[model samples]
Target: MKNLFLCSSFFDVAGILPNFLERINSNCIQTVSFIDIASHVEEYKEYVEKAKLAFEQQSLKLEVIDFNQSSDDIVQQLQKNDLIYISGGNTFYLLQMLNEKKLTNVIVDLINYGKPYIGESAGSVLLSENIEYIKKMDNPQNAPNLKNYKSLNIIDFYPVPHFENQPFKNLVEQVISEYGESLPLIAFDNKQALWVLDKTIILKDET
Candidate 1:
């Protein structure tokens, strides 16, 4: 049961599920979207509902799980899930919550178990070994940092999501400069994608 790490700025693609769904056991192909841990519990509920609507519109079968739940509780929910989607939000906050909940290890096990994964925005970026390339809120914005926020290491290098979108290009350049030329950094514009196969990665249009 090999896994494919499908990366996207968003998962609005209608056929996205079927493409990989057919490859894995139906029961194993589950979808979980990670929301911004920075938001209040009430606000996060709204976010999850909207996400559910989007997936429903596509007629995709996704069992949404709120990672903000108690750390011990998350493992039970994740035991059988296949695809865990991480939505865009504060990258550092997301990692902080993940570490606090101890859900990262469960995620690693799920991926190793051949459960496919998809991420958008913060979700996509958090999988990299380091998300230092991402820009945080400055004087105008309030962002939280939980110690040294490192990513899940699901991918070998850093990921630059939302390229061609505001402020992203600037940070990407900085990341490249800091990491040097040999790093396997991936940068994609909105409506573009990085598709994962057993042992290969392909870029495709959002449609």
Candidate 2:
């Protein structure tokens, strides 16, 4: 069964993550393979630390992987982890690195094989059928090597993260305005997340 926890801002919802995992009977997670390739830039780098702190608070070990660096053992690293996390950053750049490293299929296969997956912000957006609609919120120029906007296509609907939240509020609105009629866009705020189990998708909030 496919399991996914897609979030707008993981830091905002970290406190309740364990509860959700417990509900899904996945609270035994001891280690996580954190894909930090998205937040590769200097400014976005801070998010990686925050993510590590979140996992540390849960007493879970983390093995962070950055595709920009030597990731020859990416498959082995991912297979050893109990959970997989993709951090938020430049969506285009993140996708570019995933494609460049040719780990997209590997990730998809792992998720399909029941490895729990968590995506925050750009990470959440990357699961959609196509990331072309996100150009309004994230700069496409950041991914100079990206040949296409095609994405993991893990989920059929488009996940609009940071909805009604600062900085990205207007950008998210723009995307919804442009693609709302055509694409199946699910917009959620920093306090909300999409819990996907196989074909069933549920939107949950802190409340």
Candidate 3:
């Protein structure tokens, strides 16, 4: 019952957002909480800035939440916000933090119980059926204690973001071939996204 905006990349929002987010009204969006994972890795931190800027450009206010915060604090933020935007990062590390902090269930319950959520890259991967499709992109060793690879299963199909072109496209093919037998996979470019409202699902591309 939760509506979701699963983005491929927040950096190119200026090009993809108009047509992709046509169904959503910016005014209706009250508050947004940015669930950040990029900070865990020094390189992915820029993604957080891009994400925050993307939302601000659309007049959306946000609160940033990272692993340093407690589950209770995260839950409080989730309860106060109208939307949750989980940014891209090391998927393995992100999942590790989620488990280590015991916040996985809190997030799953919130989103399933009807909290609007947004994800880019690793964030998108976390909500899928399992992180198996991204084995090539993330290091499993980063999350050694992870017992299950199962994802939130918020969406029936698996979506691989950042499949812009060439080598990335080829990687997508490999992922699809590996998991396509049991799970339907959707590929999205940096300028594309998957929008879910109510029970309907659709793909959104740059204008």
Candidate 4:
């Protein structure tokens, strides 16, 4: 059976990450430590602590794995989780490392086994087939290196996060002209998101 998939522009502000965790029974969340890949060892402890505190504010418990120590160590560390939350960061680098460590299969298993998965920004982008279509405002080279690289493929369409933040009207049109309109483009503003649950997409607006 396929698990539920959740994609958000920004966890709490744009999506219901915090709220969703709070609403679940026990008011606690089961999260993996994928973002630790972006930090140094010295900073990871504090980072995880702060993340726990932030989630706990909304009654969630953020569990992290020191994937830096060994990316192969993620599977065991993730054994008890029911909900995996992927935080925001550099998508290209993250996917590169994940592939290097061969943790992508483990992540796919988590999703296929009825575990509810949540992703934000970079994390959300990895759920799609391609991240090359997104325009980088700061770095022109922010695009992922693998054009045919694999993603979790949890979402049916391609995603363009931070959509309304830029002049997407023209940029989107350009992409459509090149890639064809048959390609799905799900756009989200900083305060808006498109959520996927059981293969159904829902539009969520911030209050």
Clashes of 2: 0
> Candidate 4, residues 1-207: lDDT per residue as tens digits?
443333433434523555544433324444444354522312223433444555566554566665656754677666576567666555666666677677778887777765666665556777877655543421224334534446767777776556545443565456546555666877666566565655567677778
**Model 3: lowest-lDDT 10 consecutive positions:** 18-27
Worst 10 residues of 4 by lDDT: 38-47
The per-model lDDT (C-alpha) reads: 0.60, 0.88, 0.75, 0.57
lDDT of 4: 0.57
* Top candidate by lDDT: 2
Taking all chains together, the TM-score of candidate 3 against the true structure is 0.87
Better of 2 and 4 by TM-score: 2
Candidate 2 residue lDDT tens string, 94-168: 999988888889889999988899999999999998999999988999899898999999999999999999988
Candidate 2 C-alpha error for residue 167, in Å: 1.0
Per-prediction TM-score to the true structure, in the order listed: 0.76, 0.95, 0.87, 0.72
lDDT of 1: 0.60
Off by over 4 Å in 1: 5-8, 11-14, 23-50, 61-63, 136-145, 167-182
- Name the weakest run of 10 consecutive residues (lDDT summed) in model 1: 136-145
- Among these predictions, the greatest TM-score belongs to 2
